[model samples]
Target chain A: MAKVAIVGSGFIGRAWAISFARAGHDVRMWDQSRAATGGARDYISGVLDDLASNDLLRGQTVDAVLDRITVVAELEEALAEAVHIQENTPENLDVKREVFSLIDALAGPQAVIASSTSALLPSKFTDHLEGRHRCLVVHPINPPYLIPAAEVVPAPWTSTETVERTSAFLVDAGHAPLVMQRELDGFIMNRLQGALLEEAFRLVADGYASVEDVDIGIRDGLALRWSFMGPFETIDLNAPGGVRDYVERYQTIYSNIFPQMLRRVDWAGEVMTTVEADRRKRLPKASLGDRQVWRDRRLMALAAHKKKSDREFGK
Target chain B: MAKVAIVGSGFIGRAWAISFARAGHDVRMWDQSRAATGGARDYISGVLDDLASNDLLRGQTVDAVLDRITVVAELEEALAEAVHIQENTPENLDVKREVFSLIDALAGPQAVIASSTSALLPSKFTDHLEGRHRCLVVHPINPPYLIPAAEVVPAPWTSTETVERTSAFLVDAGHAPLVMQRELDGFIMNRLQGALLEEAFRLVADGYASVEDVDIGIRDGLALRWSFMGPFETIDLNAPGGVRDYVERYQTIYSNIFPQMLRRVDWAGEVMTTVEADRRKRLPKASLGDRQVWRDRRLMALAAHKKKSDREFGK
Candidate 1:
């Protein structure tokens, strides 16, 4: 089992802690604020309980996994005896730089120092670190316990050995790690996401469809196949031949339409207001937490579906 | 039950005929070629048998449902008592225009004339038709029997009444129709698809990752949630507050990376060769048909999963 040190006991940090611990890792977490530490403890326990309730926790006992997680008050204590240090501090570059420097100083040379920065590139924080060779970005999708895909984004300066080792470590820990060859903002997930949002925003801004309808367009349409296969695989199966046939048939039209869709990102302020109003109409702010649970339940159901489908048909 | 006329007896046209037939529609299919009519008969029967095997055919008997579909040789005979005409001719503007003119002259005033054209704008085909008010693009995702998403793209001249009626008809026909307020090249599905492909191509072209890894990045990652909920709805449930909070947290980086990732599309020979090599290594051309069946079976399992999950959680 890997010994993981998760710094910053916030939502993401706590999530990472639970994910590792649930995967049978010896995890230690630390936070700057004592209050946040307590909250993290409560949150992690609650998350574990939820996992147990869903029968998703595979450990001998939830207590066994919970016992493996040690919440430390000191960052050095958390980093000590760890094979990998996952820094989940605030997204501020200065905070990241400071924390990364401390981690580099405290961690052993072989230890991988990974950051859970959703948007920030590793270079922004790891560039000045003395042990920068061991550092890379390991951005996880939200609710990492359920979603196991991690984007292992390495900076231009990050060593190849570090990237390879981190990828192997993550895979060993039951996470699917995708290595980014070059560091670009948003990584892979957010680039695809931004492209989608740009068009969704444009559609809403132009009064073509409501927020609800746009959501349906994805949940009920393209995203259904996308959930099982990526764009290339989707195209490959789309035509009789394969990707080449698909491209031959559709690429000309898609290429023709690409320019018009590439518009300025207007964020659709007015449309957002309308959407907010509609969202409020459908689901009140007071019930947002309940709705969030509904969303998680749905995600769990989706995850369960993927597991079942993959097993049955090798999807 | 809706009385629908399916024009043309190609693969897509046959699929549409089965869809309507399965939905308990009095479906009359018209084809100029006798060979095409015979092909449709065999295809429809095979699809019904498959549906029966899967326990998806809701009708009393597969034969009864098949009995409802009549193969008529003349357009006038097909549109004689039809309430809605679904034109599924080859994707050519001239052919569409010719069919639209013929259908408009023959069909009654109340009959909603819809084209299953994936790429053509309704305006190009319906501008000269007398029943242009009732004419619009009702483009379906392939194999609509399994994936029931139709983009109801209306031309600027298409009546709001027509759009609403078409939407209602599609919903009644057990299809999810997303109404596009105006015509855009590629419509909604393909545009979203194009955006994804652009990124996938760029990723492969730039040598950031392997084709298989890129496919895993989506299938195992973003598309998981996307299949059940859209990016906006996913983010809405992601953070504490919802989309606004999500944007505040991740937008800075997404905005930062958007420009850098927006590379020009290079559909050059070498890029295709590289992608093909990568894909062929994973999935050979000889086994494409077998893989397609695998894809369909997976889709079936996925559909079953969605049904169960949605029902259990009321999502």
Candidate 2:
């Protein structure tokens, strides 16, 4: 097992701790505020209980996996023997720059420093670091213990070895690493999700469909197949001759729709009123935390279902 | 039980027969080409066995569900006492228009004529029918028995009663109807799907990511959450508050990336080579038919899983 460090022991950092420690990595979590670091183990312990109940703790008891994660008080100790350091600092450029500079100075020469910043591109912060070649973004979907897909984005100066090693590390930890060639705005998942969200907003803003109708189109339709297979594989198996044949039949339709999709509705603009209204109508604003918990539970059940199916149905 | 007529006995028509019959509807299927209609019962019988094995026959023997569907030789026989006539002739406008015209004439005044055409708009085919007020589009994501989302799109001249009846009819068949306000190209599912696909193609074309990497982003990442929830509900439960809070925090990130996304990739042009090569590398041309059957089996397993989870999880 590798030695891993989670620099910011908030949500994402602690979540990473569970993932790494479950994968048999010794994880050290640290935060600037002692209060955040102090509560890290408790928060992780609570989630570990849920994971154990869901049988998602990799066949280990809650304490067995939880034992590998330690809440360290000092940054130097956290970075002492780290092989992969995942930075989850606040999403400000200046803060990330300062944090990376500090980590670069303190981290071992062989250690790889990865960021969990979804908002900033890697080049923006890693450009000033001496170990920039070994630095990249290993952005994960929240609660990485449950969701396995993490986008590994590299800067222009980031070395190929770093990308390869990070991908191998994630795969070893039971995560699917989307190794991107170069850093782009929004990376892969958000770029894809942004496209769908933009269209969803336009459909509602233009009065063609309600937010709920658009939501049903996914929550019931395409997502059912998408949950197990990618879009490429979905379309690949759609037509008789696979992807090319399916494209030959249906790609023109998307091409025709592309022109109509050239327009965009600002997510926070007028569409927010309708989107928020529909959401609040379904789920009151006060119950968001409970619903979030419910979503995580649903995710856990889905994760368990996938694991079982993968064994039964040859993933 | 309602009387339903499937005017084309192809893949979609037969799938709809399974859906309607399993819902205890009396389904009659007819096709213009006798050769096509000849195998309708046999094809459906084969699929019903798979459905039976998966326990998707609504707690009935395969023969009980199969008994509800009958293959008729004449169009008049299919449309005789039908309350909902689904025309799935072909995607060609002329074929749909001619077939719709014939069905509208033969259909009873109280019956609703619904086209399963994914390509043609309802107005384009239903405009000249005398009973156009009772006509609309009820496009099903193929194998409506397995996937429940169907878009109930109405022509401009279509009455509210038609849309409501279509949606209610679909709901009775256990469908989550995306009842749209009016006819639009691509409808709801395609509009949402098209947007994500455009970004997918753009990602590959721009050298930011490979086709497989883009697929991993969805198959392993967003789609896991999406299998149970929609984009709105996803973002709703993501932040501390709700959709508004998510928008307050993350909408700016998407808005910043929107300008860069004001671009398009030619699906049939250069990108086809990369996409097809990537897909063909994973799956050969000869295995597509087997894979399509595999996809249906996976869909069946997923359908069963969803049913069980919905019962246990209160969805």
Candidate 3:
């Protein structure tokens, strides 16, 4: 087990703590807010207990895993015995730079420093760090305890050793790591999400379908196949000649619609108003908290299902 | 049980036979090739046995379900008793026109004539039919026995009664029906798929990442959440204020990338060559058949997992 430091005690940081501790890592977590760090251990304990109840816990026991995580009040204390420091402060470059500088100075030179910045590129803050070569982005999907996808993005200056080590570590922790060969804005997930949202926005805005109906198209139709197989693998198995045959048959029509799909639809105008109204009807503001609980339960159930499935049918 | 006629004995038609028969429908199937219809019953029995073994069989027993299906040599005999005629001929407009005309003439006026045309709109062939009001598209994802999402598309001439009945029938058959408010090219599934494919193509074309890496990004990342909740519901549950808040935060960024995303990337050129080459290396042409079998098995396992999940979680 690696000695891992989690330098934030908020939602994502707490989640990382659970993931690392459950993976048997000796984890230390620190937040700028003393109260945040103080409460994080209890919060994570509850999460681990929930995961155990669902048969989704990764460790031997909840207490055994919780025993591995230490909630520290000071950043230096968190970094003292760490081989890896996961920086998960606010998504501000200024905050990130300051945090990395302190982490670089306090931690051992061999220690890997990673950030959980979803939007900002690592170069924006890590370029000036003495240990910049070890800094990269390990952006997790929200509620990483349930979803295991970690987008490991490397800055140009980040060493190949760092990328390989981070990916190896993530895989060891049972997280699926998608390491970027080159830096691109939004990485892959958000870019794909952006593309899908654009068309979903257009479909609703153009009055072709309701937002609810558009979503049904995905959850019921495309997502069932997509949940296990990727898009390319999907098309690869779609045709007799595999991916090449699929492209040959559908390329003309997709290209034809490319021009029309390019047309701008205002995401913030009538579309937002109309969709928001519909969403409000479906889920009232008063029920958001209850709905969030329901969503988490469903996610846990899905995670458990996928785990069993992967075991039965090799991942 | 409703009398259902499956008007083809190809892969999709045979699969539909299994779906309807297993759903306790008195199913009659016809194919232009007598040879095609002759071998269908044995093939269906094999599939039924597989479903039974997986605990995914819908009816009382394999023999009981198989007893409900009849492989008819003549189209008239098949349509004579069909309350619902599911046309699954070749995806040619000409073939669809001819089949629908025959089905319209032979079937009772109250009988619903639904085409399983994945690409062609219902209007393309149903416009000139005497019973055009009763004709619509019930486009299922391939091998609909496993994936139950059926796009219930209607031509302008199609009546509300037709849409409602088709959706009800699909629900009874254990398929999720996505009823469109109005018809559009490719409908929702293909449109969303096209949008996703376009972005995936561009990512490869631009060298942002490899095709394998892109596929990994999806199966590992976005697909996990998407399998259960859709994009809209996901965003809804994501923010504190729900969908509106999510739009407020991310709309500007998505809008900014709209133009860049709009740029057409040729799907048939060097990109396809590169992706197809990589895909072939991963699974050779000789192994494609075995891989497809593996994919089908995985799909079955996923379907079983989803069925239990939905019962527990309530989709």
Stretches of candidate 1 off by over 4 Å are A39-42, A49-55, A58-61, B39-42, B49-55, B58-64, B261-263
Question: Which candidate leads the pack in lDDT?
Answer: 2
The DockQ-based CAPRI class assigned to model 1 is medium
lDDT tens digits by residue: candidate 2, B107-133: 888799998988788999888989999
- Estimate, for each residue in A191-230, the C-alpha lDDT of model 3 and write its tens digit: 8888888888888888777887777778777887788778
Chain A superposition TM-score per model: 0.95, 0.98, 0.97
> Per-residue lDDT for A1-315 in model 1, tens only?
878999988878888888888878899999888888887776778877877766667645678889989988888888887988888888888999998888899887768999999878888888887888788899988778888778999888899998999888888776888888877777777777777777777677777777776777788788777778877788888888788877887789878867766564645356668666766777777888998788778877777667657777785
What's the CA error at residue B11 for candidate 3, in Å?
Answer: 1.3
Best by DockQ: 2
Candidate 2 lDDT, A120-163, residue by residue in tens: 99999989989999999999999799999999999999999999
Better of 1 and 2 by DockQ: 2
* lDDT of residue A158 for candidate 1: 90
What TM-score does structure 2 among the candidates reach?
0.98
Which prediction has more favorable lDDT, 2 or 3?
A: 2
* TM-score (all chains, Cα) for each model: 0.94, 0.98, 0.96
Report i-RMS for every model: 1.7, 1.1, 1.5
- The C-alpha RMSD in Å for every predicted model, in order, reads 2.4, 1.3, 1.7
Ranking by lDDT: 2, 3, 1
DockQ score, prediction 1: 0.61
